[model samples]
Target: MATEQKILIIEDDTFINRIYKRVFSLSGFGIELAQNGEEAMAKMESMNPAPTLIILDIMIPKISGFEVLKRLKGDVRWQKIPVIVMTNLSEKTDEEKALNLGASLYLVKSDHNPREVVLKAKELIDKQIV
Candidate 1:
């Protein structure tokens, strides 16, 4: 069955965001894009159903992804939604920090292709359903 699951992508790179949007859409998930941290926060606040998952990049402008993750995990309304940190930062400390801040998973941008990322997202969403 087609899923009604929606994914919010918070990335500053237009090309990367488009790739994710296309991959996730083709995989039967709805998609939303936020070009910066401020826009991401606004979208999260205003989205009626919220998103089933969030794919975040740490280097986003206006606010860092770590801060966004902190807010999302801290808020009761959004804490349950899974967040995947997808970024070029492959440092061990960065990964540790993201996990400590409540990211469900962390994928280095160069380590996973768009399709692989989408598959992982699908798996996470499916788990949420159960």
Candidate 2:
């Protein structure tokens, strides 16, 4: 088995967070959770060794996912880490916005099950494709 890669998942919905935690855990990923943008930023700063990847939600409270992506991509420390924008935003504009801001992948939540998301995440990390 590959060494488990850590992922910071920024999602505000309790049910969704729980689902992500469960799925990721089963897939051999270490998870760090944050409910809002402020918490996300703080977690990023405090996570020991940092996270290998990030799963971001756009409609989160405070800072907004777009802003979070901007901050992450702008910072030298987090720029190279892959970010997957798993959001409820389904419009082309939203997708473009996230991609423009440096999201490595954008997946609309309603279109994919949590397990599918986890699989995609694993592939992304394995390929080291940013």
Looking at model 2, residue 122 earns an lDDT score of 81
Compared with the true structure, the alpha-carbon lDDT of candidate 2 equals 0.92
Q: Tell me the spans in candidate 1 whose CA falls farther than 4 Å from its real position.
A: 1-3
Question: What RMSD does each model have against the real structure?
Answer: 1.2, 1.7
Residues 27-95 of candidate 1 have per-residue lDDT tens digits of 888888999999999999988789999999999999999999999999999998999999999899999
For model 2, how does the per-residue alpha-carbon lDDT over 1-130 read when each residue is reduced to its tens digit?
Answer: 5655789999999988898989999888899999999999999999888898999999999999999999999999999888999988899999999999999999998899899998888887778844
Worst 10 residues of 1 by lDDT: 1-10
lDDT top scorer: 1
Q: Model 2, poorest ten-residue lDDT window?
A: 121-130
Off by over 4 Å in 2: 1-3
